[model samples]
Target: AAVPWPEVYGAGGDSPGGAGRPTRGAGALVVVQDGRLLAHLTRGGRSVLLFSRPTMGDEDGPGATDPADVQAVVTVLSSLISVGRLSPVTVEKVNGTEVMSLGAGTRAWTEAGARFTPKGLVVR
Candidate 1:
Protein backbone atom coordinates (compact mmCIF):
# COMPACT_ATOMS: atom_id res chain seq x y z
CA ALA A 1 0.00 0.00 0.00
CA ALA A 2 1.14 3.49 -0.82
CA VAL A 3 0.62 6.20 1.78
CA PRO A 4 0.34 9.68 0.35
CA TRP A 5 2.97 12.27 1.24
CA PRO A 6 0.36 14.57 2.73
CA GLU A 7 -0.67 11.90 5.19
CA VAL A 8 2.92 11.39 6.32
CA TYR A 9 3.84 15.06 6.63
CA GLY A 10 0.53 16.52 7.74
CA ALA A 11 -1.37 19.39 6.12
CA GLY A 12 1.82 21.42 5.69
CA GLY A 13 2.79 18.97 2.93
CA ASP A 14 6.54 18.73 3.75
CA SER A 15 7.46 22.20 2.52
CA PRO A 16 7.87 25.71 3.84
CA GLY A 17 4.70 26.76 2.08
CA GLY A 18 1.22 25.19 2.28
CA ALA A 19 -0.68 22.51 0.37
CA GLY A 20 -0.24 24.13 -3.02
CA ARG A 21 3.50 23.59 -2.73
CA PRO A 22 4.97 20.71 -4.69
CA THR A 23 6.68 17.93 -2.74
CA ARG A 24 10.13 16.71 -3.69
CA GLY A 25 9.61 12.97 -3.93
CA ALA A 26 7.14 10.15 -3.81
CA GLY A 27 5.24 9.13 -0.71
CA ALA A 28 5.73 6.13 1.54
CA LEU A 29 5.23 2.47 0.67
CA VAL A 30 4.12 -0.19 3.12
CA VAL A 31 4.03 -4.01 3.19
CA VAL A 32 2.61 -6.38 5.74
CA GLN A 33 3.48 -10.09 5.97
CA ASP A 34 3.95 -12.76 8.60
CA GLY A 35 2.52 -10.44 11.25
CA ARG A 36 5.12 -7.78 10.59
CA LEU A 37 4.68 -4.35 9.06
CA LEU A 38 7.41 -2.87 6.88
CA ALA A 39 7.16 0.74 5.68
CA HIS A 40 9.46 2.30 3.16
CA LEU A 41 9.88 6.05 3.00
CA THR A 42 11.64 7.17 -0.12
CA ARG A 43 13.23 10.45 -1.12
CA GLY A 44 15.71 11.30 -3.83
CA GLY A 45 15.74 7.65 -4.89
CA ARG A 46 16.79 6.56 -1.40
CA SER A 47 14.56 4.37 0.70
CA VAL A 48 14.51 3.62 4.40
CA LEU A 49 12.86 0.53 5.77
CA LEU A 50 11.07 0.63 9.09
CA PHE A 51 10.01 -2.77 10.34
CA SER A 52 7.72 -3.28 13.31
CA ARG A 53 8.50 -6.26 15.46
CA PRO A 54 5.72 -8.76 15.47
CA THR A 55 3.68 -8.94 18.64
CA MET A 56 3.86 -12.02 20.79
CA GLY A 57 1.44 -14.77 19.79
CA ASP A 58 0.62 -13.00 16.56
CA GLU A 59 1.98 -15.90 14.56
CA ASP A 60 -0.01 -18.38 16.55
CA GLY A 61 -3.26 -16.56 15.94
CA PRO A 62 -3.54 -16.15 12.19
CA GLY A 63 -5.26 -13.02 10.92
CA ALA A 64 -5.44 -11.61 14.40
CA THR A 65 -3.79 -8.42 13.25
CA ASP A 66 -5.06 -5.85 10.81
CA PRO A 67 -2.51 -4.75 8.23
CA ALA A 68 -4.20 -1.44 7.55
CA ASP A 69 -4.17 -0.40 11.19
CA VAL A 70 -0.59 -1.46 11.66
CA GLN A 71 0.39 0.27 8.46
CA ALA A 72 -1.17 3.53 9.62
CA VAL A 73 0.59 3.50 12.97
CA VAL A 74 4.00 2.40 11.72
CA THR A 75 3.99 4.61 8.66
CA VAL A 76 3.24 7.76 10.62
CA LEU A 77 5.82 7.05 13.28
CA SER A 78 8.49 5.96 10.83
CA SER A 79 7.88 8.92 8.55
CA LEU A 80 8.12 11.39 11.44
CA ILE A 81 11.37 9.89 12.61
CA SER A 82 12.81 9.65 9.13
CA VAL A 83 12.09 13.30 8.30
CA GLY A 84 13.56 14.55 11.61
CA ARG A 85 10.21 15.65 12.98
CA LEU A 86 10.85 13.20 15.83
CA SER A 87 14.18 12.27 17.34
CA PRO A 88 15.01 8.77 18.39
CA VAL A 89 16.98 8.56 21.62
CA THR A 90 17.93 4.91 21.72
CA VAL A 91 17.10 1.50 20.29
CA GLU A 92 17.57 -1.51 22.52
CA LYS A 93 16.27 -5.02 22.68
CA VAL A 94 14.18 -5.85 25.71
CA ASN A 95 13.39 -9.53 26.07
CA GLY A 96 13.87 -9.90 22.33
CA THR A 97 11.55 -7.03 21.56
CA GLU A 98 12.94 -3.91 19.96
CA VAL A 99 12.35 -0.81 22.04
CA MET A 100 12.86 2.65 20.68
CA SER A 101 13.01 5.69 22.92
CA LEU A 102 12.22 9.01 21.32
CA GLY A 103 13.06 12.50 22.49
CA ALA A 104 10.34 14.77 23.88
CA GLY A 105 11.08 17.76 21.73
CA THR A 106 8.22 17.23 19.28
CA ARG A 107 4.50 17.04 19.84
CA ALA A 108 3.88 15.66 16.36
CA TRP A 109 2.99 12.28 17.76
CA THR A 110 0.31 13.70 19.98
CA GLU A 111 -1.06 15.76 17.14
CA ALA A 112 -1.20 12.56 15.10
CA GLY A 113 -3.26 10.92 17.83
CA ALA A 114 -0.49 8.62 18.97
CA ARG A 115 1.58 8.46 22.15
CA PHE A 116 4.53 6.43 23.37
CA THR A 117 4.40 4.81 26.76
CA PRO A 118 6.80 2.59 28.65
CA LYS A 119 5.33 -0.41 26.93
CA GLY A 120 5.01 0.85 23.34
CA LEU A 121 3.24 3.18 20.95
CA VAL A 122 -0.49 3.66 21.31
CA VAL A 123 -2.52 5.02 18.40
CA ARG A 124 -6.03 6.27 18.85
Candidate 2:
Protein backbone atom coordinates (compact mmCIF):
# COMPACT_ATOMS: atom_id res chain seq x y z
CA ALA A 1 0.00 0.00 0.00
CA ALA A 2 1.20 3.49 -0.84
CA VAL A 3 1.10 6.29 1.70
CA PRO A 4 -0.63 9.44 0.56
CA TRP A 5 1.58 12.51 0.11
CA PRO A 6 -0.74 14.56 2.31
CA GLU A 7 -0.24 12.07 5.13
CA VAL A 8 3.50 12.40 4.73
CA TYR A 9 3.28 16.15 4.95
CA GLY A 10 0.71 16.05 7.72
CA ALA A 11 -1.45 19.20 7.85
CA GLY A 12 1.29 21.30 6.31
CA GLY A 13 -0.12 20.66 2.83
CA ASP A 14 2.14 20.98 -0.24
CA SER A 15 4.29 23.86 0.75
CA PRO A 16 7.89 23.25 -0.05
CA GLY A 17 8.30 27.00 -0.17
CA GLY A 18 7.05 27.42 3.35
CA ALA A 19 9.26 27.66 6.44
CA GLY A 20 11.39 24.69 7.30
CA ARG A 21 9.08 21.79 8.13
CA PRO A 22 10.99 19.17 10.05
CA THR A 23 10.66 15.63 8.79
CA ARG A 24 9.45 12.85 11.07
CA GLY A 25 9.72 9.08 11.26
CA ALA A 26 12.49 8.94 8.70
CA GLY A 27 15.39 6.60 9.35
CA ALA A 28 18.72 8.39 9.20
CA LEU A 29 22.37 7.50 9.44
CA VAL A 30 24.70 10.36 10.31
CA VAL A 31 28.32 10.06 9.25
CA VAL A 32 30.93 12.52 10.33
CA GLN A 33 34.21 12.71 8.48
CA ASP A 34 36.73 15.50 8.70
CA GLY A 35 34.77 18.70 9.14
CA ARG A 36 31.64 17.52 7.38
CA LEU A 37 28.55 15.78 8.62
CA LEU A 38 26.48 13.82 6.16
CA ALA A 39 23.05 12.61 7.11
CA HIS A 40 21.59 9.92 4.92
CA LEU A 41 17.84 9.72 5.29
CA THR A 42 15.74 6.90 3.96
CA ARG A 43 12.04 6.35 4.02
CA GLY A 44 9.71 4.35 1.80
CA GLY A 45 12.60 3.44 -0.52
CA ARG A 46 13.65 7.04 -1.04
CA SER A 47 17.01 8.34 0.17
CA VAL A 48 18.74 11.69 0.21
CA LEU A 49 21.60 13.13 2.20
CA LEU A 50 22.26 16.54 3.65
CA PHE A 51 25.86 17.61 4.14
CA SER A 52 27.18 20.50 6.18
CA ARG A 53 30.37 21.51 7.92
CA PRO A 54 30.26 21.03 11.67
CA THR A 55 33.19 23.43 11.97
CA MET A 56 31.23 26.14 10.30
CA GLY A 57 28.96 26.69 13.25
CA ASP A 58 25.65 28.40 12.38
CA GLU A 59 27.16 29.94 9.27
CA ASP A 60 26.74 28.45 5.82
CA GLY A 61 29.77 26.47 4.76
CA PRO A 62 29.20 24.14 1.80
CA GLY A 63 26.70 21.81 0.08
CA ALA A 64 23.70 22.46 -2.15
CA THR A 65 20.74 24.13 -0.56
CA ASP A 66 17.59 25.44 -2.09
CA PRO A 67 14.81 26.32 0.33
CA ALA A 68 13.59 22.76 0.25
CA ASP A 69 17.07 21.40 0.90
CA VAL A 70 17.46 23.78 3.79
CA GLN A 71 14.22 22.57 5.25
CA ALA A 72 15.27 18.97 4.84
CA VAL A 73 18.60 19.59 6.51
CA VAL A 74 16.88 21.43 9.34
CA THR A 75 14.53 18.49 9.73
CA VAL A 76 17.41 16.05 9.95
CA LEU A 77 19.32 18.23 12.41
CA SER A 78 16.24 18.67 14.55
CA SER A 79 15.75 14.93 14.70
CA LEU A 80 19.36 14.29 15.58
CA ILE A 81 19.40 16.93 18.30
CA SER A 82 16.16 15.73 19.84
CA VAL A 83 17.66 12.27 20.10
CA GLY A 84 20.90 13.62 21.63
CA ARG A 85 22.93 12.40 18.70
CA LEU A 86 24.03 15.89 17.76
CA SER A 87 25.71 18.27 20.16
CA PRO A 88 28.58 20.73 20.46
CA VAL A 89 30.93 18.09 21.86
CA THR A 90 30.01 15.70 19.07
CA VAL A 91 30.49 18.43 16.51
CA GLU A 92 33.91 19.22 17.95
CA LYS A 93 34.95 15.60 17.68
CA VAL A 94 33.70 15.48 14.12
CA ASN A 95 35.46 18.69 13.24
CA GLY A 96 38.60 17.19 14.67
CA THR A 97 38.22 14.35 12.13
CA GLU A 98 37.13 11.62 14.50
CA VAL A 99 34.95 9.16 12.63
CA MET A 100 31.42 8.87 13.98
CA SER A 101 28.29 7.03 12.94
CA LEU A 102 24.83 7.37 14.36
CA GLY A 103 22.90 4.27 13.45
CA ALA A 104 19.61 4.81 11.72
CA GLY A 105 16.59 4.89 14.05
CA THR A 106 18.83 4.85 17.11
CA ARG A 107 20.18 7.65 19.28
CA ALA A 108 23.50 6.07 20.07
CA TRP A 109 26.82 7.09 18.54
CA THR A 110 27.96 3.55 17.85
CA GLU A 111 31.56 4.22 16.82
CA ALA A 112 34.01 7.09 17.16
CA GLY A 113 37.70 7.25 16.24
CA ALA A 114 40.23 8.15 13.54
CA ARG A 115 41.58 4.69 12.77
CA PHE A 116 38.30 3.53 11.25
CA THR A 117 38.94 5.54 8.10
CA PRO A 118 42.45 6.88 8.35
CA LYS A 119 42.61 7.52 4.63
CA GLY A 120 39.34 9.43 4.86
CA LEU A 121 35.96 8.95 3.18
CA VAL A 122 36.08 7.37 -0.24
CA VAL A 123 33.44 7.79 -2.95
CA ARG A 124 33.44 5.52 -5.93
Using TM-score as the measure, the top candidate is: 1
- Number of clashing pairs per prediction, in order: 0, 0
> How high is the lDDT of residue 11 in model 2?
20
Please write out the lDDT profile of model 2 over residues 34-102, one tens digit for every residue.
444444443321233334322223322222223333344445555555687653122211211222321
Task: Write down the worst ten-residue block by lDDT for model 2.
Answer: 105-114
Q: Candidate 1: which stretches are off by over 4 Å?
A: 1-100
lDDT of each: 0.35, 0.30
lDDT of 1 by residue, 2-62 (tens): 6442222212332222113123455533445555544333332122223333234423121
> Quick one: RMSD of model 2?
14.5
Which candidate tops lDDT?
1
